[model samples]
Target: MTGLRIIFMGTPEFACPTLRTLIERGENVVAVVTQPDRPKGRGQQTLPPPVKVLAEQHGITVLQPVKVRLPESIEQIRALEPDLIVVVAFGQILPKALLDIPKHGCINVHASLLPRYRGAAPLNWCIINGETETGVTTMMMDVGLDTGDMLLKSATPIDPDEDTQSLHDRMSQLGAELLAQTLDRLVAGELTPEKQDDALTCYAPMMKKEDGLIDWTRSAQDINNQVRGMTPWPGAFSFLDDKLLKVYKVQTASGAGNPGEVVAAGRDGIEVACGEGSLLIRELQLEGKKRMSAGDFLAGYKVPAGALLGKKDGAVGA
Candidate 1:
């Protein structure tokens, strides 16, 4: 419990809080295993993973293996003498060789309740699916993808207006807190593993840019969910007169018009009709233009009353 040689495996910013919590609690984090640095941003400069940066700050040893299943990678992890490996958004399916090296095996801190939204993009899909509540699950890892037995779970409600960015930040801290509880229970020998019901499984595949395309035929609430889910990346968009109109925020309204028709365009908001109901678009970005309020956009760009969306596949943002 006190001197457990732990190896922390994770990548993105979502993974940082758990690692930070482990260190803050004085857990024996001997090494950090994160994905390799790669080109990012418009400059395409190679940058380290958020986990690596955090680990280095605390002077913990860091490891970046292209493929965790490779011989060298396996050997490196094996030599760490890890009693347990705590993985969070590690971005790789660890092989059994590495998983078996640790005395207590690997434990994953996932972002969703097991058997539901289990896959690469659970955070994004949970919102897109309009789930009412979701939470963190710490599970004993196996060869399968998020198919491992669950050790602990903590649930929280999803806010109606919550975007992925805001929800992600909230859940990152939530996962950290839940993981601390899990580790303590594990150390106390009070943890019980629960098998997930396959009958309740739902896969949340990785998001695509095309997935953000707003289908006017869908209800306003559904489109609103899509907008929330894709926020800050692969953002929800509609074609505005052959141009990409990125929709950042929207509120459901009660007006009536043909789907995609502009109910009204003004300083307050751009009211657009949906299949079932209308939407008050509060914020958006035109192609090759900066994101702005609907009022500001309307002040400059031309969005007439009868203008249609989804007319064609508009150009992608520069």
Candidate 2:
């Protein structure tokens, strides 16, 4: 433990927590590697990765390699001579050459229970698929995508009303805690990596902006799942007069009518008909407008009774 020199690789806020946790516990993080600063936000300002900022604040050496697989970047990390490399949401795949450089090998703190949710956006997919339980896993690095030997894991129950934003915060902290404990065992040589069962593997594909489109032909439950899954990012939306109408909050309704019809509207909310049931839209935001309650949207807009509430049938890009 006394001579353990660590190199930490991470990018986002999710990774910041783990880096801070390691530093607070007095670990020797010899270097920090994160993605390079990139244009972000509406103004397109160049912003540093969250992990990079934290590392600089603590006086840790920061490396932002644009192409991690390049020979130069691999050589830089190899020269560090780290005892272990800790990665959390590092935003890049590691090559075997870099993985072999560390004395104890690399460890990844993944937000999902592997072999399930193996891709980039695991937490969002878990909520989208309506999973009641999900957890964190620390695994030994491998060349395959999140296909690594499990070192440690712990589960937490998902609440019925939990959305991606809430669940992500919880999982982020949980991953930090689990990762710290895993490093403790590694220092003591008390941990053993276990191979994952490929037969039970599931994948969580990265989300696209077009994936947020709401189809009235899906069940209210599925629609609700999408709304929760996409919240705070790539929001679930429908079309109204060929404009995108982002749906922020909604609940399943008991009543049913023709799909895509606004069956009722009042202070309670706007109940829109779905394929199998209905959705009580509690919160929404129309394009070029501020987010407002469904009741407020109805108050300002002229939505005639029995009028269809989505893009015209067969209209492209609706």
Candidate 3:
């Protein structure tokens, strides 16, 4: 509620909560800076980013810069005279020119506890790596990647069945709450910055579509994590008879056979043997078909016992 000249920068749905919180708390948000609208989905229709839509609804100025480091973009930000810059999942790096223009510098709402998951796609990587706990961090932005002093943090435990989409929703709201508290404490001058230990750093690189390919050679538990970690994005997947079969949910089971071999198939699920154990496929999407339960899939499609499943590449499973 202070008279700080705040400028919000973000693009995806993950950043919406923090912006909404600032607006609700009566922050003087002068403008919203987000990436340029781009084509998305099957239609390839160009649409405004969620942040831009939210900002427009609130009657805040929206800025879509192709490159935030451009001289014109830097001058545009400098013209705003922002006392503080708040960045969530903005997708663009703020150059030194724009960072220096803000009176209070820049504060970032990172999706992980730095310096643990300090790169892009932290949420997905945490689950993919089988991390039992993770959280959000508000850091004072710097030239380096999430290497700034941490202002505040909020942690949450990862559930056994948690996926990226579910965890993303929860963490988004949590981040908003934490950022509100951080801003209040900053205004009251009651906050002390904490330095992150670089030795604990682990990078979560940007994900690619191919990253979702399932390798049956791994343990059942590891493959299960990979399925959930990539959910609603690239999607963990394998091949059945040279066709793509996307896997959404799975449960570890006890079995012994060659990795990727279909040891059992029935109403409960299709039990496929893994390198160590096996996995019961609960949900999946086969090529030229809709996502369905294992039972429904079994009713029409046949995943016969002793059948192989894995990458399309020529291999034992293939």
Candidate 4:
């Protein structure tokens, strides 16, 4: 455990806590590898990944290889002579060459219980599927996509109103703590690596912007899940007079009308009909407008009762 040379690999805010925890705990994090800076936001300004920022702040050597699997990248990592490589949400897949370089091999702090959500965007898919519980897992890394041997796992209940942003923040912290514990047991040689059951595995494929398009034909609860899962990203969206209408928060309500039809729009909220039930829109953002509560949105813009929402050309309830 003493003089453990660790090389950390990660990107995004989800990975920040783990990197921070390792550094703060005085672990020998010799170097950090993160995704390259990319243009972001409306200004198209290039920004470094959160991990890079944290690593630089601690004066750790930072690497941003475009392809970690490449010979040069692998050689660069091999030169570090790290005892272990810690990964979290590092956008690229690590080849076996790099995986085998570390003495203790690589470990990942994944955001879901393995053999379940075993891909990118696990947290988002878990909420969209209406899972009652979810958790984090620290695993021994392999070449396969999250198909790795597990080290430790910690579970948490999924709140009724939990959105991706809130769940992400909570899981990030949890993953950091769980990873720390896993490393302790690993260093002590007290942990057994458990093989994941392939039969129970489900993939959380990377999300796309089109995935946020709301299909009102789905049930109220399903739509609500979509709203919650897609928030702070490609937000759950329908159409209002051909303009994109992003639904930030919604709750199930009682109403009946054609799917996607506005059932009520008043001071309380805007109630929209779905195939199975209704949705009480609590917060939303129209294209080119700021996000606002349903009441605030209704104040300036009127959605007449019985007007249809969703794609103008698509068949209703298709």
**Top candidate, metric lDDT:** 3
Give all candidates' CA lDDT scores. 0.90, 0.88, 0.93, 0.92
Q: TM-score for model 1?
A: 0.97
Per-residue lDDT of candidate 4, residues 1-318 (tens digit): 346999999999999999999988899998999999999999999999988998888899999999998999999999989999999999999999999998899999999988899999999999999999999999999989999899999999999999999999999999999989988998888889999999999999999998998899999999999899998887898888888888898999989999999999987788999998999998988898999999999899989999888885844442
> Which residue segments of model 2 deviate by more than 4 Å?
1-3, 312-318
Candidate 4 error regions (>4 Å): none
lDDT of 2 by residue, 29-79 (tens): 999999999999999999999999999999999999998999999999999
The stretch of ten residues in a row with the least summed lDDT in candidate 1 is 309-318
- List RMSD in Å for every model shown: 2.3, 1.7, 1.2, 1.1
Model 2 residue 209 lDDT score? 84
What is candidate 4's CA lDDT for residue 36?
A: 90
lDDT (Cα) of model 3: 0.93
How well does candidate 1 match the true structure, expressed as C-alpha RMSD? 2.3
